[model samples]
Target: MKKLFFLPILFLLFACNGNAQKKSSDKAEEKFEVTKTEQEWKEELTEAEFQVLRKAATERPYSSELNDITEAGVFVCAACGNELYRSEHKFDSGTGWPSFDRAIEGGVAYGSDSKLGYQRNEVHCARCGGHLGHVFDDGPRETTGKRHCINGVAMDFIPDDTK
Candidate 1:
């Protein structure tokens, strides 16, 4: 009886470990259009920007000024200046970070993130492969019904001439 119980626990442990390893290895094989050395990226980006954009870290909620801006313009990747979310798609999801209903076509990519022990749809910069944030299904029903909760540190806002 003891041997049987131990076997099942061991199997469960190995199964969980294997899944984690597979996810990480698959992410490692991915390539982006704008690639750079870690040192080169560190030199170009500020410490905070590097953390969020390169290391997949989250910023403090409501800490970014971009959350307050309602101007008409575009939000682009800070790493590569690739156009991402447009002002028209942005909304106050009240999550502190800049939230968007949609991204500019083909400007962003999605990946799986289970870092927090649960599955999440990870968002990335398609041009540079920088981690932007996560997307959730809880959003406005009037539109795409997707909430793209993004870190402002990973992006730069460009106000339109009219704004």
Candidate 2:
């Protein structure tokens, strides 16, 4: 009886340890590994892109150039040109900013953003760590309840040329 109990306990410990290590590795990978300086990002991004991607600025609602864009294409990071969102996932959130129910797989990530003391998830470009915007739980129920509220300056819409 003692041997059986010890075996299960040992198994449980190993399982938990494995889970912890896996979570750590996943976190490390979720974070962008780029080491570009601010000046480098600034030089690479336009003035508006720098404001949104580097300073975490928010563009006014309903003011995005891509808000009305309906052509099928990929939306890429304006700062680093990283593919972030698919045009198919883009949707109207009635919040003014460009909203998406999902992102290209592994193209973006969320981190704790406390700049406003509200503990929101700060969205970033997975390829470059450039700030995109905050994500909210209030989204269309037809898909993920996560709304990727992106600043227009952080993304460039590419219309599909296949048409």
lDDT of 2: 0.80
Q: State the displacement of the C-alpha of residue 132, model 1, in Å, after optimal TM-score superposition.
A: 0.2
Model 2, residue 155: C-alpha shift (Å): 0.4
lDDT of each: 0.91, 0.80
Total backbone clashes of model 2? 1
For candidate 2, the per-residue lDDT at 36 reads 74
Residue-pair clashes, model 1 = 0
The runs of at least 3 residues in candidate 1 whose Cα sits more than 4 Å from the true structure, single-residue gaps closed, are: 1-17, 24-26
Tens-digit lDDT track of model 1 for 112-140: 88889888999999889999999999989
Clashes of each: 0, 1
